[model samples]
Target: MGSFEFLLDGIVRAFELIVTLNPYILSITGVSIKVSGTATLLAAMTAIPLAFALSFVQFRGRHAVITLVNTGMGLPPVFVGLFVFVMLVPAGPLGFLNRIFTPEAMIIAQYILITPIITGITLSAIKAVPEPIIETVYTLGGREKDVVLTTLLEARFGVITAVLAGLGRALAEVGAILIVGGNIAYTGSVGGIGEGLSYTRTLTTAITSETSKGDISTSIALGIILIAIYLFVNVAAGFFRRQD
Candidate 1:
């Protein structure tokens, strides 16, 4: 009974934090959106094109390339994070840019993690496109570029789904970003929310942090928002799917 009451109380306070727009909560959410959004956007830009190429072009080692992409889709986030960390450290070859422990580094980590996922899914979608579509394009004297565009049009829904899937994965990711971003927050109060507002902290990381600190309300608040955001992404995906 006591435990139940405590959970109920925590939930109520969580709602309060959400309703009142707590700065710490909003800051965390914003970082989550910004980093994931940017990384997913960049990934979509590159992955969609790459998928189209993989589907349209016949080149030496193309099968090997596809296999590599498929393998990358399952790469462990923690392992990717460690790889990025090693590269970003001052002594590493790419360390001169000094991107470690920053949002940029987090973006890079997430981009690496999701690019292959987007590419693989989109490639499968493109492959699933009917052969007649390409044949029809060629029969009409359409050029290679036209066939690519036509296939992309046919696979639009799948491409969108791929992007959303990547975004969902990015938003829910903690291990890579936590390692790369260091989950930093500002030191001083910025919005009178008691806790310092997040700088690099995100909803996933913040939930882990707050829960560890025994700040149940904050954790619950972040969780509620995270669930809501995920639902929104799913709903958007469903809506696009229904359009086909």
Candidate 2:
């Protein structure tokens, strides 16, 4: 087939898989959402509070903590994967949890990877809150707690963008989850598509595996889904920013 024809065929096949709910494709998409979604939530919880604390509190080593968070924002995903793999290995320090090669391991790795990104962005957002706005809260009989709350409300949109950014990073990530999650699937059949329910086979890893096995149609389907999700997240973030 000609290149255009081949590309057309792939797009048609991808849409078919999606509309038909191809078992393998659905399973991979599910894993991607569950793992990345959970990690993003966990990261947001931790990062938001830390960001707030860093913004409001004057304490020793504050600069050090900010520096560390900044550094962590750029951590290499593959190196994080290796570190988590080691920590979860049979003889490793946390091996007793026996979470290696599991969805939980993937969550942990992704959480570590995205936490700093969220925290750093959130911190910046909080810092950007106008000093006059904070002072206005205080001028209106607001206490320290009120000031913090008011600042947080003002920065809410930016913080939401930070969380979305982390979610996007988590969803697109493959290296860390691949090492820790193992991308395994159980033997099974679904909708007569001869697909197995995935344990750790997220969309990104599934695309890699499917393409390597010459399942170009499946790969294309997954790639389309992944891009669609990333786009949605970014668009949502932009909307919230505009509202802010």
Candidate 3:
């Protein structure tokens, strides 16, 4: 009975915190969205062309490249973080960029983590496109670009699912972003209002912090929001699936 009452109290407090727009929670949520969205967009931009090339072009080492991409799908995030940190270190060749421990660094890490996923899934989608569709477009005297575009369009549903899968991976990730971004929250002025921002303190990070500190109410609230976001993504994916 005591445990049940405690759980009920925590739930009520969590809802209160969410409804009241707690700054720490809101800030973490904002950072998560920004980092995840930017990573997804950048990954898509790069992956789409790579997917097309892999699907339609024949060249030396093509099989090797595909194999590498497939392997990247299961990459360990902590290892990626360690590798990137080495390259971005002060003495490293490209260290002039000074991208470490910033939102930009977090985005970069996420891009690397998610790009392989995007590429692998996109390759699957493109390959799933009917061969007759490709040949039909080609036989109609369509340009190579036109045929590729048509193939992509025909596989649009699968492509969108691939993107969602990449996003799901990105949003749920922790290790890479935590390592590169340092999980430090920043405080400063935002449009004349005091605001806190963190390059790495995503919803997951916030939940971790809250749980460690025994802030069950806030942790529960953040968990709810995280679940809501995942549900929304799944719902959106379902809509696109139906469209395809």
Candidate 4:
């Protein structure tokens, strides 16, 4: 086939897989959403609270804490993967949990990678709150708890944006999860295809694996799904920013 026709044929077959909801495709998509979604949720929960503390509480070494957050925000994904892998591998510390090459391990790696991102963004959002509003709360005899709550409400939109950013990062991530998760799929065949249902496989990791193996059709199918996810998240982020 000519190059144009070859590319067109691959795309056609890709859409076919998507339209049919091929079991393997569906499985990896589901796993991607599950792992990224869970990690984003957990990171938000942890980061938001910590961000509030950093914003409101007066404590020593606060600068050091902020420095750490900034540092972590730029941490390399592969490095994070290596760190987690070391701790989880047999004979390594914390290896007794035996979480290597599991979804849980992927979650843990993503959590570490994105926690600082969420925290840094949340801290900035909380800091952006107008000083007068906080003063008004205090003037009205509002306690520290009330002040914190009011600030959180004022920055709610930014927090939402932060969470969405973390989700996007988690979804697009491949390096860390590839290492910690092992990009594992079932060993057996499905529909006579060599690939099986997802075990720890995810869309991003699967795309890399498929493309590297020269399975252009499967890679295109997965790429379509991944782009759809990214579009959805970006749309949501845009909506929330407009609300802000």
Candidate 5:
């Protein structure tokens, strides 16, 4: 076939796969959402509280802590993956848990990778709160807890945006998960295709694997799904910012 014909054929096949909700594609997409979604939730929980503490409390080495968090925000995903891999490998410190190459391991790696991003953004959000607003809370017989709650409410939109940012990063990430997740699929075939449901195979890793195998249709389908996820996250973030 001509080049144009080949490209058109691949697009058609990709559309078919998506329209039919191909079992393999659906499974991989589900895994991607589950791992990234869980990681984003866990990171938000840890980050928002830490952000509030950093913003409200006075403590020694606070600058150092802030610096560390800021630095972590730009950490290389591959490095984070390597760090997690070392800690989870058979001879490594947390190896007894035997989580290496598991979905749990992927979650842990992604959490570590995105926690700082969320925390840093959340910290900025809280810091952006007007001092007078906080003072007003205190002036009205509000305790420290009340002040913190008030600040959080004021920055709720920014915090939500931070969470969405983290989710977008997690969804687009491939290197970290590849290192820790092993990107392995089952050996058997289904519907005359290799391995219907992947154990640790996510959309990003599956895209790489499919493209390498010269399965252009599958790769294109997965890429489309990934882009859709990223766009959704961005739109949500924008909506929250507008509300603010």
Candidate 6:
């Protein structure tokens, strides 16, 4: 076949796989969504409050904390994966949770990987708020909670950007999830809290498997789906910002 014909054939095969809703493909996609979504939610929960505190409070080592957050922004996924793996080992303190190789473990890893990015970006956003506005709020006898809320409103767009950055990190991450969750599909026999939990398969893992198995068309299909999801997320974030 000519090069163009070969490309067309690959596209056709990928489309067939997608249309067929192959169980394996669907399973992987579902795991990816669950882990990424949970991670993002957890990161947001932790980071927002931490960022607000860092921005508004006068505490010792606050600068050090900010520096640590900035450093964490560049944390390597593989290293994070290794760290989580160790912590989840049988002798580890959290080992009793039996979370290793489960979706929850993957979520924890991704949460750790994304939380710092969110916190750092959010700190920047909060700090970008004008001192004048903060002072005015205080002058008006606004309580600390009111001051924080007003500052957040003024920096809403920046905060949203931080969230989007965290989402991007969560969605794109693979190594931490792979190591912590073992990238293994849950069989019916594995009983526990993680028994029915989605196993570690994700788009990245699916693509890796397909490529390793020489299923180029299937790998391409997963890649296309991953790209589409990322784009959709970015567009959705934009819409939310515009609404705000």
> Pick by lDDT: which candidate is best?
4
Colliding residue pairs in candidate 3: none
For candidate 2, what is the TM-score?
A: 0.94
Model 4 misplacement above 4 A: 237-244
Candidate 2 vs 4: which has more lDDT: 4
lDDT of 1 by residue, 1-244 (tens): 5999989988999999989888889989999999999999999999999998888788999999999999999999999999999999889878999988889999999999999999999998998999998999999999999999999999888888899889989999999999989999988865665679787899999989889999998899899999999899889778867876
TM-score per candidate, chains pooled: 0.94, 0.94, 0.90, 0.94, 0.93, 0.89
Cα displacement (angstroms), candidate 3, residue 210, comes to 1.7
- The predicted structure with the larger TM-score, 1 or 6, is 1
Q: What's the best-to-worst order under TM-score?
A: 2, 1, 4, 5, 3, 6
What is the model-wide C-alpha lDDT for candidate 1?
A: 0.91
lDDT of 2 by residue, 122-190 (tens): 998998998999989988999999988888899988888899889989998999999999989887786
> Model 6 over residues 3-66: C-alpha lDDT tens digits?
7887677778777867887666667778888888889988999999999999889899999999
Worst 10 residues of 6 by lDDT: 189-198
Residue-level lDDT for 183 in candidate 4: 95
**Cα-based lDDT for every prediction:** 0.91, 0.91, 0.83, 0.93, 0.91, 0.82
- Candidate 3, 80-132: lDDT as tens digits: 88877777777876679998777788888889988989999999989888789
Better of 4 and 6 by lDDT: 4
Report residue 195 deviation for candidate 4 (angstroms): 0.9
lDDT of 4 at 151: 93
What C-alpha lDDT does candidate 3 achieve relative to the native structure? 0.83
lDDT of 4: 0.93
RMSD after CA superposition, every candidate: 1.6, 1.6, 3.1, 1.7, 1.9, 4.3
Instruction: Give the true-structure RMSD of model 4.
Output: 1.7
At residue 205, candidate 4 shows an lDDT of 95
Error of 3 at 151 (Å): 1.0
What is the lDDT for 78 in model 2?
Answer: 94
